[model samples]
Target: MELKSWFYYLITHSVFNFRLLIDGLNEVPNNRDNLLDTIGLIAESFNKVKICCSSRRERLFEQILQHNPSLRLEDLNYEDIQKHCYRRLHTTRARRYAYLVTEELRNAVNNGDDEVVLKRRLGECPGEMHKLFTSLVERQDKFYAKDPKPYLRLIEVATKRGDNNNHGAGAFLTFFELLVASSAQEEFISRVPKSLDASLLASLDSQAPDLKANVVVRCANLAELVPNRSDLQSYPKEFAYKELVNADSLEVRFIHRRVQDFLTDSEEGAALLRSYNMTEQNAVIRLTIASVTRFLATPYMSRVGKSLKWESLIEAGFWAKNGTGALDIIFPTLQARKPLRMPPFTAEDTSINGKTPPFNVLCPQLSPLENVAFGFATGFAMVAYTEAKLRALDLQKWRLVVGFSSCLCVRAYGLGRESSGFLTMFEPYLSLTSLTQNLTLSYILEPFTDVDFWVFRHLSCVATPRPGFHQSRF
Candidate 1:
């Protein structure tokens, strides 16, 4: 019926992605006419249950205020951001970041009294957030540029300018990963390669995403960024630009690698790589420049890894076909505990099949119900004329973001014993153990950008139907 901007689409055939709202309304007509179920599935993708909402933007801010009038709101003012970030950098080239031992951060890891400080201070630090914001801001010219300064601050700018459609949760969540990955452990940096220059370390974040890119991550045993103190040490140029990445110099990569460590076993990092490769039943083999953490970011990738060409699946299956399911399924597919099954779908009842849509046929006698008043609107308020008609239902604009924030509260508290008050307060608000288990997970999931609009209709189950509350696959 209509065609949207091709550039706006990853799947090229749906207007239902809340983020897609910024684009022209060209692609929605077809899906509206041919695939109502697909639209529904896209809407359901916002399900970040720990937040107890799909997180699509509906200006959730006002709505959240209505629910919790006392909820805190950080003013992302440029000056305030600068002040918070000032803590990150030195007044001069030679100033040092108080590299004070952040031990309580780790000590609180298992469940301890120091957990609250870790959650409140370390988790929401102004400096860390600013770095992310700066990276996002610079994205106009240099998103993920071959520099750490750009990466940290670019993400910050993106957050402060929260998207009215999907809110700014995805980028906001990325920060938690940094905190998790980059612990201020005193000893970890002892292993950092001294061959690289300290000044050049800030360039690593931009380098990490490239498939063939070569980068090293470590913490500096003795490193500090002083704005004007170029005299502290004479460093070599070869190691300065691309090789040395650490917390102060290359914050993003340092944080990212820590998260990378959390995802894959530390001991296995080296062994996982070979000129060729080795097979691990649980892990993907044949390591490449592109990390596994990068591959599963999109649904299309998951689908490709799951479904394959006819000849490939058949050709590989003739030997025994016993593990045929695993061979043809999504590569490094997210595992369940003992047995895994694709998400449930409704088995259709063909007896009632007809030209009429399923909802109308479900209750022919009640078909007249479409005329009843449901809200401030006239008749058919809830009666969607087409599946595409079922759209974002927002009583408030920022409600999705606020709802998502609520989920983060649960996760922050639930992950460790820290922030017990916040944890306990928000504990009742959400249970996103599934989503959290996969939180900030770049490759384990199919990236939202790759979802196929037409394929969405194939989903018969509710969004995020986690089978066992306690069991999860990495």
Candidate 2:
């Protein structure tokens, strides 16, 4: 009562303007009801007194303050957030340009260029963000300038990866993966060490930071190394190669979304591509090859007889899904080998494994290369089939349907799988005349089973003839 009376006196008799602030009201543990009543009384009693409080939206507080003029923190700081982001981006870009200019100045001094000429070159450095990006893309450096294709390819891959909105979207290339990918080309392959060991691991660990720094420079500081969220250690134990290296847990990505935007913007993007003699298809092909090389190089079988073959296949599939004409190049290069065979699962195998193996019940006829190819085919088919179906649905055309379905059938046959189910699903749309006109399909499926041919003949007899059926192959 005395405390209440004191509060009433203070609220009623204060001559100057009074402002009261109670922060973290929800954190109060005792006498909250009385505190609320006091706050309500003070707010309602005097016109001169103003009260402001901060708390999370708890029901107790909401009951009293619901009708009052309240501002959310997000609303209050939205512009501030935008300003902070812009400031950081501007600062990073400014630093990069400064570095580039300094290097150019040093080169000019080495070459003994005239002062006026040097000044003119320095003046070429751009002031605006988009112009800066364009300048960076066009600029020549001593290190990467000789062979900018690899660096530009990396940028293209990163940009495309960002644009994808499907599964595994926004996943950046890990530093180790980037190193492998960047060095996978013929010119750079010799630089990769033949084997991974403790000594090599130490060397790689020491070189990783320098490599990351060099990558940023090569990319005109448009790319950055960020902490990788995926756990490398958790990979299957058969990946002894992983355990051999002290791989950095950092992934490569565009320094900013705006950098990606500048690279992907149609008009600007075309010029950028022309600057490096790069195409989107070529970038995907390079990544697919890189992934395959990495998978083959890493020994997936340990002395304990554990195999990471399935896991490796899945990893290769991830990259192969984006490939364009990759298989044609990849398959012919691989050496032919006998099919791999696995023994039947036993009680001991189940107990030792503690889980069902991924391919324990799989066919024994597929060689290691075939297994990898199957993985590639599976990924390719998933994306291709969806795209074809979407196109067919949008245009309401049977030609597109037959084209994609025929392609899928070829892939299934190549993987040694029956495509009867797939064919049956699109049976209604398959036309006899269209199917007969697809010579590529007929050639590819020439070795297919009698049952498949029978189905084709049956479809031809029952279905309406559709013209302009196109054929595609992997």
Candidate 3:
């Protein structure tokens, strides 16, 4: 569909349809370059938009601004906007595009494109296309005349943003910035006569209405802050959306790439998991073969393999240079480490220091306890990166890997030996094992697998930290 039609589709859709909303952005031209730009546009177009993202998405946005200079995408500062949401800002610009379908947009606007399809597609009200057209037709003169009705419409739309709690204010605030860029904000504010602004502010009787006054003025200021789009008409319809979509795509990929680390870690270090009965290292080989086979068989990550013919990539000697042998990502922990050996959690196991060392045991690949530790380690690294304000995915991902790997390597030197208290496991299973059924297993798994003692202690560490009483550091 054409971009305008897609806009209609977007504005008319529901929140749940957001994923499709993003996927549909590809219909625009120069999709990669303009994704963030279009995203900003979509945000402004809506009455209220709330946004959230995975950390990876935030870093993706950071990367785009740094590497792609001319695009000049703004860094959305989540810290400044925390007043709007309970969580960290992780949503990519894709989310903005997804959120533009506000109730007002969903209200009948007539572009006269596929009415039946529009209703079936929009799913909000019956004959939505006609209803939308009617609103635009009736309001065009008022809008062009700079009447207060437009401001009222904006206020009314803002009122309908039921989910004001979830950064609706913040995201819409960014959208206001988008409107500023689009010259829409200036138009919007200009339409609000001083009398209307005064009246609205005076009558800002409701909570949302009160927020509306502040948000509108801020939006107007933000709009005024943007550099003028000297040649908005020159902006290509097809290319605008494409540019915005592409910007978003880079961010999404940047995040999933982080996920790849854990998956690869699970597989490489996962001693027992077998895809189609392929064993350990050989299974990895087979996994690659099966990947190629599956790519040949169908199309999943088929882009890497390219073209339908299933040629053996192994023979291609990717690292040899026909294709790149270099890994897309590196896991420093995946090296040939000391053998997976752990001392049995015997009664003799006791700590040399009064306080047992965190861990000294050498655990097997992806042993449940080890997986739990790996989870903790990965999570800890992620938190550190956030605290450090590193926003690039590769930087965060690799940085975490480096830190976690270093921690692991040092522990591998002798981590599990210190504490047997952590290796303990659930006691109910002891009955199944006879010995374990009667009592909680002793000796934490530090060096030994299935030692019941240390497991719980390690878990306590992984559990969310107990909230401390607030005290002034000063």
What TM-score quantifies how close candidate 3 is to the native fold? 0.15
Q: State the lDDT of candidate 2 residue by residue for 417-464, as single tens digits.
A: 445444444554553343433322322112334433444455442223
Q: Give a tens-digit lDDT track for model 1, residues 143-196.
A: 222232212222222222222222121222122123212222122122121222
Prediction 1 global C-alpha lDDT = 0.25
Stretches of candidate 1 off by over 4 Å are 1-82, 86-110, 115-255, 258-278, 285-320, 325-474
| Model 1 weakest 10-residue run by lDDT | 371-380
Each candidate's lDDT (Cα)?
A: 0.25, 0.50, 0.28
lDDT of 3: 0.28
True-structure lDDT of candidate 2 = 0.50
User: In every candidate, how many clashes are there?
Assistant: 60, 0, 56
TM-score of 1: 0.17
Q: What is the lDDT of residue 440 in candidate 2?
A: 27
- Order by TM-score, highest first: 2, 1, 3
Of 2 and 3, the candidate ahead on lDDT is: 2
Look at candidate 2 and give me any clashing residue pairs: none
